[model samples]
Target: MKKALRWISKNLIKIYAFLGFTYLFIPIIYTFVFSFNKYVRSNLVWKSFTLENWKNPCKPIDICSALGNSIKIGLLATAGATLLGTLIAFALARYAFKGRGFVNTLIFLPMATPELVLGASLLTMFLNLGFNPGFWTIVIAHVMFCISFVVVTVKARIASLDPRLEQAAMDLYANEHETFRRVTLPLVAPGIAGGALLAFSLSFDDFIITNFNSGTTMTFPLYVYTHEKGGLPAQANVIGFSMFFLALLIVIAGQIVGRKRKVSA
Candidate 1:
């Protein structure tokens, strides 16, 4: 009985982890498999295996356009959010200033707020400011929410860095600008990359907030949600699979680069 309990204790975590991954990946697996299915109108059921969907991902109406819009918004938002948030993170981490705590708290509030409320609030603000809801509005909203996440992520990375590195550079007669460019930026690059990736993912997948801010701009998630009434085409599944694989490839490439850098170092 004692051996049985010990074995169970040792294997329980592994079992749980396996289950967790399986649950998370089941939908993705289904989407990938169905991408190759030949369906007339809807991808509800797998009819037969065919490469047409993969060959022509733009076969579905507006799928390509929506995806393009999503990509555009995601890239723009990620760029803006990462730049702004990295500066804020650096300020909070490197310098002491009055009302710093208040600013930090304000940054945290955006992350803590519910998406629905945030969306509505943004909509109201845009209306009050006479800013029409459209592609730019969606981008603005994405940047607003994504900035908090970026700041949180980059701030943690900045905090984790050793101050001695900068001091050493200074001792060697390097100016503040040179030390930051040569020492600080390189060390914190991974964090910025991670934050940008996260921001892009969030912006790309956003439905609720985008729906609120986007007047007529159709993003990928909004397109998927709206087109579900007619059942999404197999090409939609193809797009999903493509995005999954693209993200996976990026992650794998990043890992490989990191490994190479470590080896060289």
Candidate 2:
């Protein structure tokens, strides 16, 4: 008993990590496994394995279109949120301006607020403004909530930046614009990229806000939710697994590129 207890104590952390990862990945593994299921209508039960689902991921009606809409909204929202948030982050980090504290507080409101409340409020605002709920509305709603996360991410990066680098550039006779373009932008690029990626993921995964604002237009999440009464199609699982793999590949590629840069530097 003593030997067993000691062994367990020594390996507790490893065991915990293994269990944690297993718990997190179980659903993802299930999704990947079910993607190969040969189901006529419902993918609830695994009948037989087949490659047809992956071969024709877009075979299901409107699934690909829904994915395309999500991609479009994610891109637009990420672009808008990253641009605005990066500027806000820089301003907050670099300058002391009137009402800066107020602005900073406001930035956190959307993030702190519940998605249901935020979505409903946005819906009300859009209706009051005589705007129709559709693709642009979804994009706008995503950007609004995603900005807080982007600002928080980029602002931390901006705060960590060494002012001495900028000072050194100035000492070397580099003008303000030139220094910013050459040195500051490069230093800040990683943070901006991280923020953009985060924003895109959040926008793509969003369902509540999209549902509240999207009247007729359908996104991937909405499609999945709407079809839940009917067993989820194998195509949905295929798309989900493909997206997961694509995201994993992107993260791996980014890590490789970052390591190369560090080694070269």
The lDDT leader among the candidates is 2
Model 1, position 71: C-alpha lDDT score: 98
Q: How many backbone clashes are present in model 2?
A: 0
For model 2, the stretches where C-alpha displacement exceeds 4 angstroms are 1-8
Clashing pairs in 1: none
Q: How do the residues 23-80 of candidate 2 rate in per-residue lDDT, one tens digit apiece?
A: 9999999999999999978889879999999999998899999999999999999999
Residue 221 accuracy (lDDT) in model 1: 93
lDDT of 1 by residue, 133-232 (tens): 9999999999999999999899999999999999999999999999999999999999999899999999999999999999999999999999888888
Tell me how candidate 1 scores on lDDT.
0.93
Candidate 2 C-alpha error for residue 256, in Å = 0.8
Question: lDDT, candidate 2, residue 107?
Answer: 99
Q: What lDDT is obtained when candidate 2 is compared to the true structure? A: 0.94
